[model samples]
Target: MEYTEELLNEFYNPANVGVIKAASAVGKIVDDENGEIMKIYISVEKNKIVDAKFQTYGCVPSIACSSMATKMMIGLTLEEAAASITASAIVKELGGKLSDTKTRSAEMAEKAVKAAVKNYSKK
Candidate 1:
């Protein structure tokens, strides 16, 4: 299978693969059927995402999507983060054209982020 440089880079050097010292919310994935597992931590200040990170174990697409989403949401307000984040957005940021199956990773990343943000908003 052929992969682009963007895919390779994201898969090999994913950003935000650590945990935040203090997070308002943490989204934990406990499903393996999809083979895309991710745990995200979000730090919120004044309803904005001051910081975000995740620990994930999945294929290249999943990793890239998660990494990209984390980066995108870093300084965005919760509303912006929720509105701007999506599987298609991740794919577009990666230059588009991901396999249909691989696209789930992007969706998973979006859900994870939203879940984390929701948890934080509750607190």
Candidate 2:
């Protein structure tokens, strides 16, 4: 698959690629088919996300999507991030579309964000 320069950049030098030890929320997902796992950590303050990070073990798109998703979440309110961060949004941020097979990576990012918000709400 042909990846955009933006996507390649993110893939090669992903941002927010770590854990937030004191994260307010955390989300994790695994791709059943590929056994790829993605984990997101978010630290929220005053209803806003002060920081976000991710650890993904998968293909290039998975890592890129996770990185971009977390980067996009910073400074966004939890509600806004939850509502605005979608698979399409992640792909868009990555500068274009992903193949059908790789689209799951973006979806994983979306699901992880929602899961993190849900986890936060429960606390």
lDDT of 1 by residue, 8-95 (tens): 7888888888998777889776557966688889888888888899888887777888888899999999888888898888778877
For candidate 2, lDDT tens digit of each residue in 52-97? 9999999999999999999999999999999999999999999877
Instruction: List runs of model 1 lying over 4 Å from the truth.
Output: none
Give lDDT per model, in order: 0.82, 0.93
TM-score of each: 0.91, 0.97
Quote the lDDT for 85 in model 2: 97
Over 4 Å off, model 2: none
